[model samples]
Target: MAPLASDPLGLAIDTTFDDTSVAILRGKREVLANLTLSQFKDHEEFGGVVPERASRKHLEAIQPLLAQALTRAGVGFGELDYVAVSTVPGLLGSILVGLTVAKSLAYLLARPLIGINHIEAHPYANVLAHGELPFPALHLVAAGGHTLLIHQTGHFQWSIVGRSVDDAAGECVDKVAKMFGHAMPGGPAVDRLALTHAPAAHRFPRPMLNDPGLDFSFSGLKTAVLYYRRDHGGDLEEGPVLSAFFDAVIEVLIVKTLRAARRFRPKAVTVSGGLAASQKLRAAFEAAAAEAGLRLLYPPPELCTDNAAMVACLAAHRYAAGRFDDLTLDGRPNLLD
Candidate 1:
């Protein structure tokens, strides 16, 4: 890797509505400044995420957040060797805010434009903090919009081994949380309650565990939980039942991820994306990896969620490999490839 001395400086712009994070990477080191839209904490009164609300929030945060990242990196526009942006596989409006800004910057500065895939960037977020990803790596990305198991064959190369048949884990949690009047992004709130509540107190079915492949199905589980709530309607309130529901959700996530790891037989397993912040999932994956005798790697909780650091790290890898996308690159609405 000696000729790689001229490590391309990497810049990433993440306009994901949940958070607007920007990062600059030199070699593999991350220099970052991120901003979040706090409106959700206020809007949680509705008990779920509103897409339109998220879109507008991202638009307001994009420009100022980008400037902060540049300033913190202390790199002038002229010095940037690469400009990276996430163009697809995300909300259309939110995706446009970032692509437009990054595209314009790439054109103005005459730097190589690297359009990154949003889901692909999740695992590399771990690479940003941890040097390189282990080959045959299994990553469980649990975010609001996606729940997928990816096999990491090498840098920037992934084959989706399994995916959700219906709702993603995070989405299920959000919807279920709303059932109990929990706030937006119900994962955190549920996790907090789960800490004091025992998971074995109630029995919730683990979907797709009996089936083949690493694929997962949570829609049934969500509905099952709903039916449980309905059948037990007005059963004199709540102590153990609520605990059981939280436990059931955590179990489903842990079990499915473990199933993926067992099937992939990876050198290491990474749990990434927004829901990776969950303490229950973290503990569950760690314990499972230990029992399975596989290494488990995860980004710091804050980085585990959506961020630009992962994008920058991926860009750095692609840049070193002489891989660069042309300006003609378009944002893919379903840019999994």
Candidate 2:
């Protein structure tokens, strides 16, 4: 079929954190453009992401990125059928930046506006990668900000079975990487180092694994690493220490998620979020799924991080379900609330 001006389009904006990302999609999974501008360098010197700086960068980068997405997708505003934004589970100011722009566009273009939960939209990344999510599925979301295990019975019908009681898995990874003197967003660095090295002789404790529940706690694992480095810095290399730390986190995640899958009897299991980018974790999951005789899925590394394509894909479902939001929709900074 020939492309037509009348073809409907969807636009997604994501400013949930330090990155400003815009995505354009035709229908659901057909992503045309996903332009993201990373602002990690601006906050890297601060040792962590500064919320105010993240918000300012979003305001500056969003318009240009939106323009680039539209141009790259070869679609104008007139073709837009809906506008979507990651509106919650983020810094208030940063989420507001994207939501305001989305609302204004919705009003001007008379298109439907969909406010997506950043944490919830993560599973949609898998949906974008693999069409039609299997019902009665288990979803482990290990993004930097949130870690939740969702039991999904259908679209928009899911309940959290487990969540981080303290530090998120991705946050633990970043802090562990910073111990090796890497920058703030150091999960990638840790992943690279972990790949090159074997697990350390020092075995870190897997937190909450024996608690008879699905909840997780990585703060203890992180503190164990701190104590190990302080007490025996000369005893181990960074590569091995990092490997052991990551393995601790992965064990807790995998064990708890698999436990939930067995209890819930889900048809398949899915992993999403920033930590899902880890090849080691993916390999471990692949082996576990193979052994357990269960189906497993995850988005590619690019989709694992903060991006609007997931938001857009989730919004496409909402649009089809008539789940449009009015201009009065406001930002909710608290992800759980």
**Clash counts for all predictions:** 0, 0
TM-score to true structure, per model:
0.88, 0.92
Candidate 1 local lDDT, residue 64: 54
Q: What is the lDDT of every predicted structure here?
A: 0.75, 0.86
In candidate 2, what are the lDDT values of residues 172-265, reduced to their tens digit? 8899888878998889888888899998888899999899999999888888888888888676689988988888888899999999989998
Q: Ten-residue segment with the worst summed lDDT in candidate 2?
A: 45-54
For residue 188, give model 1's deviation from the true position in Å: 0.3
lDDT of 1 by residue, 1-337 (tens): 1244376777888774456667888886555544344423454432344334444467666655566566767777787888888876877777777887788888998787888888888888788668688798988888668899888889877888888878888888788888888887788877777666665455887787777677777888778778888887887244355557656666766677777777777898888988888887678778877887889898888777777888888888888887888877777667455
Off by over 4 Å in 1: 1-5, 16-18, 37-54, 235-239, 335-337
Residue pairs with backbone overlap in model 1: none
lDDT of 2 at 18: 77
